[model samples]
Target: MKTLMKRLRAFALSGIIGVGLLGSFPALAAKTTLTVGAAATDVGTLDPHYATSTSDRTLVAWIYGALVRFAPGSTDPSTIEPDLAESWQVSNDKLIWTFKLRTGVQWQAGYGEVTADDVVYSLEKSRDPKRSAFSADFAAINKVEALGPHTVRITLSRRVPNLLGLVTNYAGGFIICKKAYEERKDRFGRAPVGFGPFQTQSIVAGQAVTLIANDKYFRGVPKIKTINYRFMSNNAARDLAFAAGELDASAGLANKSWLQRTTSIPGAVVDVFYPAELTLLHINITKPPFNDIRVREALAYAISTQKIAEYRGERFTRAPKSVIPSNNLGYTDNAGVFPYDPAKAKALLAQAGYAKGLTFTMLSSQLPEYETTAQLLQGQLEESGINVQLQPVEHTSWHQMIRKDLSPVVIYGAARFPVADIFLTQFYHSSSIVGTPGAVTNFSHCNVADKQIDEARTEADPAKQVALWQEAQRLIIQNVCAIPLTETSQVWVHNKKLNWGFDLKGSMSLGPLVTEQTSFSD
Candidate 1:
């Protein structure tokens, strides 16, 4: 009781003192340093063209500005605004997109003006499959031709209704400086240059990335002077650091217990947001037992999404209706495929020639969230006579094994929203088979949802197009390619005095971290 009062008094006194000194010692009264602790050791790449991992995206946002950007710190796709391109127009047929670039956008590190050539070159590189993991995003563009120094035209083979959404920083929307790239080549990945509100002061691979505010930022310069992003992979350690004031913010964990405990700290503020993340389990259809549709349906019936969401903590979790999460564009409620009915599960199992029930090994990551959820699922499956042997493996090795088609079941958690076609094609199209043709993330190795996906992409009318996407989602659910367990919320704990520049709606990248608009109140 005394400790709490003491801490509370200290905050009050600090605020009072800060306010009193502001007029006389304004510079000394302002707080300048902002530190963000992330739960990652390394980024996949620093090059904006190929940086796709969470860590990479978070840091890259500081350096790059996409042609179009999602409204800062917002998950709402409707709030997209112009970046390098001041305006854009699409042809009546929607196959051609013309952009009017903004004038006088300066590049970092002595690079010259950002021009049509740079925009076209950056997008073309993003379109090359060999160079970019996100090439699939830019694959629809037939050609990117520069009309002039300040104008660019893009020709698409067919209509892309969601192409505008894909250009955001989270997607393949970041523009690059061609001159800087040709001069640096592969070295550009380590030392990137861009025109954003902040620029990299220094970066040490796998350790920390330091950024200084861009004084000449097109948008106003950030009130905070420096942002130090530290890599702390351990959840407990990261949380402890935030609680002790070593960190101003953290990557925000999914676990609820941590949130409950951390929010109790004096002057700490915790915000939870549904950041388009879905926790799902993938059933390999090519595997012997799952090859039978009845077996897949039986397994689905056996696992209870309600129970799974409950086990994951209902406060931060919601039961997912299908493989396509509710946050995505084509979301529809066809939740009837696998309602929790053990009797129906057993009957289907018997019909599939497994009268005594079936047993399979499910490979899960060694991370606490994955391991604990797997164990909880194991208990839930027993209720339906579906025996599952949960094997915990290293996170990296687990992903490799699942992609290799080794596990009978693989648990995956990802979110592709606003542009639902990504989930539809990458996880459902047969050509997207992980180790095959496209070398995509499609571990299901099935193509039942391809037709609907293709139709949705080219559909001219927005309403009818949505129906096509809904049909594709229904197909994935009915076919039992994967089982969605829950929509997990990511949580961020921060100091109360830290003004994050924007209200916490949700972030597609960094969860409630400081931005150019962010500053300290005291």
Candidate 2:
């Protein structure tokens, strides 16, 4: 009887243990879903061509496919590799570029074949001022012609050494379908047509955007069936969502403390990348007080970048001495010209005839970093006898004010690119000056500086062009065009279980995140 009882107990225990093991196996092997959160201030417009803000760019990247995409491991973020375009060659003079399109690539909708004509149309429409695309980064293209079903030719007015780099940029050369764009012009931005691994499922402006797997994508469909991009208004809220497991990933992380706090969690991982964005103080040169170069220089010298970096946590920040970060190509250290000197600042203020000290409104957004920097500047300037009134504004309003050149001083962030042209051209070009209610350039209205910038733009030789850029930088520094502050590092927080190897750079590149090489593990 004892032997029989022992045998029965052993059998029951073994069965129970087996069942427990089976239950835990799934827990260990379950597939992970990554939810990325973005601190979006406003809802993005459905039109990819119309997107101007960084928030819109984040969403557009998933839905749209470019002719050539920036390779993940390239030293230069703007260097191009084959995407829709299999290969490309530039003429000896570098004026003309011929691109050979990849074969067997189809649109997500399977809406007929994608030909070179589609590329031509997309470029043409983007450059068309009538279309009013705020994102016309490729307006410099002289012309685009479809050579054949699989080939396209681009002619430039002037030789662009960084032509290929520009083409791979987020704003310049995203390819779209001609048929779909024409048919769904109104809905295309929300429901974009692309050759990416994912297709747009839905977009609710200012709220969330969703993408689903494109089974027919030439590179093969993404393993993840769906991607949801949720818009949280601020980093604090976004971080909270991530900690709660409501989000898998968060882009443009603004809070270092929160990120550090979350990394302690078992499934959390903090990914730090070199930020492509520079946090700077933009002085309105068109305005009265700031128009004086002396005043601008004084203001620039008043703020201490070293202190700002220290206070903000130096691990994710670096004091930037030039408009372009040191990591970028063609960047030269120009710190000597814009050295911090409180005594010199005060002297300049007196020389500018503001001996009684100057008081002006300094504008910044509600985000913690901007607000903190603004306050820090305020204190620093006050010591130099300059009273800076802190004006904290909403993100949308702040953008508008900066574009209109309404504020005396404004805190701004710019994502750095491989080529210096991207920064110098857009910000300093006279033609790019925003004049109306919603101008993109913030109406700096700098005509004299514009002429010098134009000369640099047309210069073809890389060495010559760089010399010109250096000259331009010196000129801007002399005029105190804008106070270059610091380069803000990009920090990404993710769930450790989802393994998508990505390096932190100045800007976020989505290509690697969606590539086949990216895989998840429990």
Candidate 3:
């Protein structure tokens, strides 16, 4: 009886141990996922053609590819190399372009092989104003035609400043699988199909966007099997999540204090990138007293851009010397702008018939950068007896509201292809005036530089094109259409264990990219 009892206990112990081992097996088989914390409430869209917001742009870069692309870990236009297309050609006059597609590139979710037909379809969508936000950029394209299953050709209506920039993998240049998009229609943005390293798995609204590796990816399977992109709008919470090991990477605050605090985190690596985004305070010229040039000049004179730039920290930000960003092809530092004179600003305001002071309400984004800048602007404007009542709103909502012309003063920060024509056309051209047909982000409704901007677009001579752009900047600055504030570079932080495949550098998408070779070190 004693022997039998011992045998029974041994059998039970063995069964319990077996069950525990089974539980550990599943843990060992778990996927290697890189969890990321993005600084946004939610993604605006995943459709590459319309993905303007930073979070959306980041995801688009992972899910889609263009004919040519900026090399991984690079933002320089010169670093552009073949992506979907193996090779390409251009006509002597640069009016026609041809691309030869790579064979056997499989689309995600068994959407089948990518072909010239798909390229034709994608470029057409990019050219359509109703279908793409970047239609203005593709205006020079007369036709996109598929010569065969593996060949595509483009015909340009006029010579463009940068034809490669338009076709490269940024903004509307991202290719979409034709069959999948036609089947999904409007649901395509949510359920995307592309031939990139990762395939979209799921998106939990306001929570996370999960992507899994494409085993059949032409570039080779992504070593990191999955990506869990989470939206954490609150900066402090996002940083804490990273500190607690819940997030492998997170978008970082641009200011110095946050940088210092984050650097103190054990094993944390901070990346400060180049091609700073120029911030412009756009005064709506069509609205109220702002229609008067004196009022706009007064506002410009009242706020010292030097002080505003320094407030964000000298390392992260720099005062703009021209309407065009510092590094652009046609940037001119000699564009005359008003001096910081509070007394002069008051005189201008009084001349514009607001001697007691002018009060106006401006909608401000809750995003830390915009809100802090708005507060700083409010205090500075008050010194010249100009009152600006700020009404804070969510960042996404602020983007929508400002587009609807709800805000008289729109503080916008953006970086485009390193060119003067792009910045001038989108922000100062009469064609891109806000609230009009074919309008873009022209919050000021500025049309003063129409001639210079229009001429610069097709200026055949390089020097003449640059000259036209410089003159446009001078005209816009003199008209006081917008106050060029500062340029703020992108900042992000990641775990030291994380290897982003390429060296840390500038990214056009304004974030670090996780490529096929990306992995975490033990």
Measured with C-alpha atoms, the lDDT of residue 371 in candidate 1 is 72
**Per-residue lDDT of model 3, residues 370-413, tens digit only:** 88888999999999999899999988788778878898889888
- Clash pairs for candidate 1: 167-173
Instruction: Give me the candidate number with maximum lDDT.
Output: 3
lDDT of each: 0.77, 0.69, 0.88
Clashes of 3: 0
lDDT of candidate 2 over 1-522, digit per residue (tens)? 999999999999999999988966645644534467876656445455666556666666666677877664343554457888889998887889999998778887877667899889888876665554443356568999998999999998876547666556366467778899899978786777877777778777677777787788787766677777787867668877877888877764434465557767768876666534677676678788888888988988888887777666666777778765566555678734577789999999999999989998766776555776778788888999899887778665676666656676767776635566667666656566666422345334544455555666678677877777766666666667677777776666777777664443433442224543344665
Preferred candidate (TM-score higher): 2 or 3:
3
RMSD per model, one decimal: 5.5, 4.2, 4.5
Q: Residue 373's C-alpha lDDT in candidate 2?
A: 74
Q: Whose lDDT is higher: candidate 1's or candidate 2's? A: 1
TM-score for each of the candidates:
0.87, 0.87, 0.93
The residue-by-residue lDDT of candidate 1 on 1-522, one tens digit each, is 999999999999999998888888635558788898876665556787666456677778777887887777677788888888899999888888999999888887768788999988889988776666567666588999999999989999887757777677664678777888888888888778888777778878768888888776677777888989898877888888988899988776556577678878899888777565777777778888999989998878887788777656666787888777677776777744478888888999999898887888888776556777788788877877888988877564565577677777777777654567877776787757777736456777767888888888888778888888888877887889888877887667789989887778776664553567888896
